[model samples]
Target: MTPKEAIRLAINGRTDIGQVRDENEDHIGWYNHPSLPMGFVVIADGMGGYTGGSKASQIAVKCVTEHLETLPTSTFQACTPDQQLLVIHSKILDALNAANAGILDAKVSAPQLANMGSTIVLALVWQDKVTIAHLGDSRAYLWNKDGLCQLTSDHSLVQEMIDSGSLTVTQARSSRVRNHITRALGVTEFIEPNINTYALIQNSLLMLCSDGLTEYLDHGELEFVLSTHRPALECCYRFISEANEMGGKDNISVGIIEYTLENKVSVSQANISVPAPSSAPVEDVTVRKESRA
Candidate 1:
């Protein structure tokens, strides 16, 4: 169990023997480091042949967790809003690169795994800051003053249709193309993931999950449930249960984060600060060429 502090988290995850497959190919993990109240939540949904799909998702979670462990602990100790965002952006990019490589390496040994890939969504919270980075269809949602806001975009064909106005939300529900994802870890040699950073105050909750959960619930439904829930963990439990009741067609994973309001602290009493950088921007190299007919 991860030692939770500022945000107490309760996690509930299950893989279903849905209408199609024999095993669920999803992986999830959550932990709070002893060095700080900050914690991380990760979920990966795999696709490919038998052994290959499972390994791809497992490798994704391991790679991300290992990369986070190597970062300087000071990054999470507490800092100005800008500094926190910089640290998060840099670290997330590094982890995604590593996870991509891990999947590719696995493919080299087993050629059948060449197309093995997984969708990943990872969220980190340290004090009042929240950061999310994702690839593929896994998502993150926040229940706050503005209501439920989806923080990650789906990288699937159905999502593209919705974005392009070719399909309405109702049409997407039954679209055979709903499962076609545009991106994944080992499907290609390189991947550029989306990273998001935001600030959180009191009365905020975050939901990190795979499509198994979101595919069944609308934004308004989730908001009302999460807002009225008890422990953060129970919220996760209910979400999964509801999804299963509707149709547990895939693996389910969820991570919840609830921020407790901290008393207002004066600037002088804050524990950390970020100093401005002193170096100037570096210039890019260029070469000129002339052509003659």
Candidate 2:
């Protein structure tokens, strides 16, 4: 049986031009594979001038998805979680190199595509495990009983400053170089992706979004919506809408995945029967207490 008929998942994705741009260079997509505990979803935000940016993001998404599709199922089942993660780490670096080469070849004669690059954040749901591979500033968040936890650290200049103790979390948020990404696909032939694997629990929700969403919503807001919401699709839409309502200055894209005891959740049909968040805003900014390495 196909994944559609075997395991059930709810997915809703949207990309907006936002309040700042005439074109949307962000892309998000989910692919459900049959006969495996694997689900692939990716979100890419391109950075370049016009067509170059859009094309670079599209290429990154396509390359990663295609590479995953061609990978043997034995790869996932053949090793421990840590070993699998290492293999995935190697694959991401290899794929980024290939993508960079492709982008360079495409831009050899066209100056418009010369300096194009993209931030890639990929999530793989396999059985009870959530594997995340990320570069640039896009992020992954997990929502459970403990609330929302950021699964990846951004590869940006501000992040570097924070690491060096040159900037505080509050200062990094409003830093001039906050948007300046330090790592991305196609910018360099050698790229390193931070890879992690989490043991997912039943009735958990995983969210993947570009920086556009985080630019507005705080962790408390995310926890409220994700933990309280029943339908995954609505949560995804509300996220994008809220981002736009709060002055979306860049392209926005979001993808959601909800885990269950059995594959019973329907994608088109959502169970909209959950309690709402408290009528309060969570604007508290907490200090960073975790190390990136």
User: Which runs of model 1 end up more than 4 angstroms from their true locations?
Assistant: 1-20, 75-81, 264-293
Query: Residues 1-293, candidate 2, lDDT per residue (tens digit)?
Result: 11323444555567777899888888877876655556767899998878888988888888777777654467566786556666665565565566656666666767768888899888877655666777799988777676677777788998778778899877876788889998787776556667666665445677899998988887778888887776666888888889999999988888887665466543321211212223221121121111111
RMSD per model, one decimal: 9.1, 8.2
Residue 146, candidate 1: C-alpha displacement in angstroms:
3.5
In every candidate, how many clashes are there?
0, 0
Model 2: residues with Cα > 4 Å off, grouped in runs:
1-8, 72-90, 263-293
> Model 2: which residue pairs collide?
none
At residue 151, give the lDDT of candidate 1. 74
C-alpha positional error of residue 205 in candidate 1 after TM-score superposition, expressed in Å: 1.1
Worst 10-residue lDDT window, candidate 1: 284-293
For each candidate, the alpha-carbon lDDT, in order, equals 0.70, 0.71
TM-score of each: 0.81, 0.80
RMSD of 1: 9.1
